[model samples]
Target: MQINPPGTVQEQRPDALTKYLQHRLAQRDREGNLRRLPQPTTGIDFWSNDYLGLAAGAAATGEGTALPCGATGSRLLSGNSQQALDLESFLAAHHNQEAALLFNSGYDANLGLLSVLPNRHTVVLYDEYCHASMLDGIRLSPVKQAFRFRHNSAEDLEQKLRRYAQPGTPVLIALESVYSMEGSIAPLAAITGLAARYGAAVVVDEAHATGIFGAGGTGLVQQLGLEQQVTARVHTFGKALGCHGAAITGSRLLIDYLVNFARSFIYTTALPAQAIDAIARAYRYIGEQPALVVQLHDLVSYFRQQLQERGLRGWCDSITPIQSLLTGGNAATRSLAGRLRSQGISVSAVLSPTVPLGRERLRICLHAFNTRGEIDLLLNLLSSCPNPDL
Candidate 1:
C-alpha cells in the first residue's frame, strides 16, 4: 500500500466530508424532501406533543425557586443530588415499580437500557414500527439475535418467539405502548402473555403514552394492570408531561444493572434540578386532576368522529391523540403541510428516512386545549383540498 504524498489530504479530510454531505443533501433537495428548521408561529395547536397544555403553565414562568440552575456532572459524579433521588423515588411509587432510574432524555434512556443490558447471547424481538431510538440502541448493542415482528401483531410475535427461543438463552421483547409515527398502539396484554410462556422479559417504551393513560398518568402498561408482567417501562417527560427527561421503572436489580452498565447514563451529565422540578410538578398536577386525561381522550374521540363525518381517507383509526394522514410521498405531504400552515394551522410532515419512502404523512397531534371550531376548520380544509389522494 502507498502512503499519502506531501500536502495530499486523506480520504477522511474535511473537504471529502463536506462533499459527501453536500451530495446527500442535494439528493434530498432534488426529491423535494430537504429538511430545515421551522419558523415559530402562533398557529392553531395541532402539531405539538404538549398533550395537556402543561407547557404553557405557570411553571414555565419560573414559579418554583427551589431548582438548581444546572447539573454539574454525571449522576455517578457531582450530578447526583437529593432532589434527583427523590424524583426517582416518586416515579417508582407512581409507576408501581421497585425502582426508577432517570436519564437526561427518552433517547438516552432507550440507548442506555438496550445497548448496555442485552448481550451477544440475548435475543431481542422488537416491533416493526418501534421508535428510531430503540432501533438505534439495538444497532449499537452486542446482541446477536434480534428480529422484528409485524406491528401490533401478537400472533406474529409468538411465531418469532417460538422459532428463536431456547431453553437457556435470555430473551427480551421490545415494544412501544404507542407507535409515535403510525399513531397505533401495541397489543400489550397479548404480547406480554407470549413473553411469559417463553420466559422473556418485556420492555415497553411508553414515551407517547405517559401522562395520558394509566391511573394518575402512570402509562398504558399500568392502566391495563400489566405493570407486574412487564419487565421494564420507559416513561418520558416530554410528550404528555410537558417537561424534559425520562425514567426506566422496573425491579431494583434492573435499575442497579443499568446504573452500572449503561454508558449513556454513566458517562453523561444528568438532568438539571429545573427539569426534575418540572417533572415533579407535572406529575403532581396530573395526580390532582385526572380529568385532564379524560378531556384529552374526549378530544381524540371528537376528532375521529369529525374525520368519519367528512369521509376523510388515510387517517389512522385510534382513540389516541396522534392521528396521521398518509400522503404517500414526501413532496405531496410537504405541500399539504404547507397549505395547512398558510391557513394558520400547525401540522408536521413525517417524511423519509424518518419513515420509509411512499409512507410520508401529515401528522396531527390532538390535545385537551384544541377547540371544536379548530377541529372543524381543519376538517373543512382537508375536505376541500385538491388532492388528498396524493
Candidate 2:
C-alpha cells in the first residue's frame, strides 16, 4: 500500500502521493470496483427505470428536442408555466387529490414535504429502508424529534406510535409504497389504518409504484382506495412515467400551505412548459393504453418465476420490477456486476453507504419492453456466475 503526504499536488515532486492514489485505484480495479462513465452505446438495456420503454419512444422524440435541456431556473421564480398548472390539474384528478404541486424531482418533493410540513412540534416516523431523499428531508426538518421502525412492519410502527403519540404534536408517518432497492411492497392499508387509529398523518412516497400499480397507474394509494386516508402522497414521473418532475398530492389547503411555507417549493423556479407537457402526454398515453400496466405485471411475474425455476429465488425478495441480489462485500458485488455487464446486461452494483456496509448487491430492474427470452438469458447468466451470493 502507498501513502500520500499532505499538500502534495499532481505537478509537485511527491512520489508518496502518486503511489497512494495509485494503490487505491489498483485496489478498486482488482475488486472490479473501479467505476468509469460508460462510452454511450446502443445495447441491450436492463439498467434504466424506463419500465414502459416510453422514454425512448416516438412520443419523446423531436427535432431540436435538446434545446431546452436545462430547467434554467427554479419553480417559484422564472420556472412557472401553463404546462405546470395543466399537469397539476391532471395529476389532482388522476389521483383524486384536492391539489398537486410539482417539484424538480422526487428528492426535491420529499425534501420540501418532510422538511417543511413537520414543524417543531411534529414527530416523524419513517421506514428504516426508505430512500435517502426522505431521510435527508427528515434531517433537514426543523423538527428534531424523529425515529425509524422496521421496514414495512405495521406492528413495529404501531409500537412506535404508542410510545411517541402526543395530543397536539403532529405525527407524520413516512414510507414508500414500493421499496426501490428491494422491490417489496409496503403495507399501505394496514399502515394507513394504524395512522387513523393513532390520529397520525401519513405520507406515502409512490415513486416506484407510479405508472405501474393502480388503475391508470395512479399509484398504490389509489390501488388500495386509501387516497383520503393518507395525508400526502409523492409521485415522480421519471421512472415508470418516462418523464421528469415529481408532485406532492394532498388537500388544497396542504398545497396552499406548501406554497406559502415550504421553502423548497417557494424559492425554486418551476419546471418548463415542455417538461410539463411531456408529463401530460405521458399520463394521456397511460390512460389510453391500460394494457401497458398489465404487460408490466406479467413481465414481473415471468421474471420472478424464471428466478424460482433456476433455484435463485433466495438471491432476491422482490415482486416488483426492482430485483436485488445481496452480495455482501462491495468487492464481490462489483465483480458480479462487471461480469454481467460484460455479458451485455446493464445491471448495477448498489454499494455502501447507499445500503448498509455488508449488504451491497446487484440491482436488476425489469421493464415491460424486456422480452421473456431476455429474462431467461439473464437468469441463466446469474445461475452460471462463479459467485452465487449475488
Candidate 3:
C-alpha cells in the first residue's frame, strides 16, 4: 500500500480569496450548517415569520401596478417620497412617540441607532442573546466599551449597569422585545425599571412583537406601559405585518440626531412608495381587523395547551406564537426537520453558530391561520420523531 498524505490527487488552483471561501464552505458543510436558498413549496406553513398571516396579503396596488419599482436614491437625495413620510407620521402617532424615522430594514435601523447614539464616553450594555444585528451595530459603533448581561436576567443587567456606572458618562442598555431564536420574551418591565434607577437609556427592538401583542398590535413596549420611559423603540413591518421596512420611534430630537449622524440611514436608498403603501395596508388591516390578533393569541394558547396535554409544556419557554423544541445536535435537528418536510410540513432547524452547539432546535412559528388539526398533526409528528443517528 502506498502511504501518501492528503492532497495527492490535484495541485492547488484557487486563488487566495477563493481558497479561503472554499475552506469556510467546506467546514460549514462538515458541520451541516451550510445554508442555501430554500425552494418554493405548498407545504404547511409552520416555518415562516408571518405571525399575523399577513405576508400572504395582496401586493400593493392602486389604479394599476405602474408605480415605480424603486425610489432610486437615498432619502437625503431624491428618494424621500410623500407616501413614505405619511407612513412615518402615522407610525409616530400610532406608537405614541413624538416622531419616527423609517429605515430600509430592521438591520439598518439597529445599526444606525447604535452607531449614532453612543460615543467614546458612553457605556453600552446589551443582552447576550440580542439579535445579531444589534450586536453587530454595537461592535461597529464608536463606543469605547460594551458589556453583556445574561439573557432575560434583569439582575445581571443591573449588575452590568452598576459596574459601568460613572459620572458624566451615559449608559445605553439595548435588548429585544422578543428574542428571535429562543422565542422568549424579555423582562422588559424589570430591565426598564433597572435602567431608570441607574439613569441609563433604553433602546428596544420590537421586530418580533409588532402587530401581535399590544392594543391593535402596538408592540410589547407599549403594552407594558413603559412607552414614555424607553428612549427608543425600533419596530419593523416585515415580520408580523408582512411588509418591508422598519421605523425608529422616539422623541423628535432623537429622530433629528439620527438623521444627521447615522451613516447607514444617510447613505442608503430610500424604500419605494409602493412598499410604503403595503405597510400602510398592513397597519390598516390590523386596525380594522382586531379579531386577527385575538385569534392569534387564542391559537398560541391552544398550542401551549396541546403541548401540555402531550406532556411537553416544559420543553419550551415561550408563550407567544414563536416556539422552539430542542434537539441537541445539528444533524439530529435537520433530520427532524427533514422528517416534517417529507410529510408535507414546513419547519426549519436552528443549527450551530446561529445557536450554541448541542442546543440545535426547531423554530416553529405559529400563525392565526393554522388550524387546530394542523397543530395536532405537527405535535403528533414531533412526539414520534425518531432517532436519526440510529
TM-score of every candidate: 0.83, 0.81, 0.82
Measured with C-alpha atoms, the lDDT of residue 366 in candidate 3 is 94
Runs off by more than 4 Å, candidate 1:
1-66, 388-390
The CA root-mean-square deviation of candidate 2, after full C-alpha superposition on the true structure, stands at 18.7
Task: Let me know the TM-score candidate 3 reaches against the reference structure.
Answer: 0.82
Clashes of 1: 0
Task: Give the winner by TM-score.
Answer: 1
Candidate 1 residue-wise lDDT, 1-390, digit = tens: 121222221122122212333455567678885443223235576654445544444256656345455565677755676778888888887887778999989999999888866677788999989898899999899898999999899999989999988876778899999989888989988998888788787889999999998777878887787776787799999999999999998776567667766788888877777888999999999989888888899999899887777777887767799998889888888889999999999999999988888878889999998988999998899888877562
- CA shift at 250, candidate 2, in angstroms? 0.4
Q: How many residue pairs clash in all the candidates, one count each? A: 0, 9, 0
lDDT for 287 (candidate 3): 86
lDDT of 3 by residue, 301-377 (tens): 99989887777642568888888888888888888899999999999889998998877888899999999999999
Candidate 1 collision pairs: none
Better of 1 and 3 by TM-score: 1
| lDDT scores of the candidates, listed in order | 0.80, 0.77, 0.79
* lDDT of residue 278 for candidate 3: 88
